[model samples]
Target: MVFGYFSNKRREKMLQQLSDSRPNLTRAEYVNRLVKKGFNKHQAEIVHDVIREFIQMDNFSIYPEDDIHKIYAVEDLDDVELIDVICKKLNLREVVQEDIDELDKTLKIFNAEYILTLTNHISV
Candidate 1:
């Protein structure tokens, strides 16, 4: 009887885990999400492919400096970090962070756009 009870509990736990898992999304759906966030269809598609490939890489990590926690979604990435990395990778304009009011405002604007651009609705 005890064994049976434990087995039933294990089964229930497994079922719960399965139900809690998020469903996988189609590529089109992911692209649509990016488009809605202000990216043109072409840009969205390109970004989608980039993100997909990045996630699939064996050693792909948003936060390479930190091994304990890695970013898998847009939310996991900070705007400053995202913009900094992207700028460096693409040779874009450099961004500076300041604690003053003007700098804070500039960072806010960049964050608003960068967050939407880097983040897809799907979990990596």
Candidate 2:
């Protein structure tokens, strides 16, 4: 439908903007940067994978500081699905209402680094 076309076009533009805002590091570089910031290698990789999965953008161009809310509009995103995927991929316990509520609280100006923090609080 016409609405779908426009929505896709808008999404593509937003993705380009997001990509242009960050340094294009290789996956290894991204992981290293995260490790330097104190995330373990496994945590860094999981965060990268989650962002790459949700944003459909090259992880190389996505940095820890990137605002997730800007990259994907909150209203348009399925928070439950996102949280579920993160939990599943991270081998954390299944998503619960508290997890959803916690995510909602952090949704404002949330960045990639916050994902790492969130996972830390959620049980494995």
Per-candidate clashes come to 0, 0
TM-score of each: 0.37, 0.72
Off by over 4 Å in 2: 58-60, 74-77, 100-107
Candidate 2, overall lDDT?
A: 0.70
In candidate 2, which residue pairs clash? none
Question: Against the true structure, whose lDDT is highest?
Answer: 2
**Worst ten in a row by lDDT for model 1:** 61-70
lDDT of 1: 0.42
Instruction: List lDDT for all candidates, in order.
Output: 0.42, 0.70
Candidate 1 per-residue lDDT, tens place, 1-124, comes to 9998997577556544543564444567766765676665654455445454544433322221111112342343443454455444444455544322334443333332343333321112
Residue 111 miss distance in model 1 (angstroms): 10
Q: How accurate locally is residue 21 in candidate 1, as Cα lDDT from 0 to 100?
A: 64
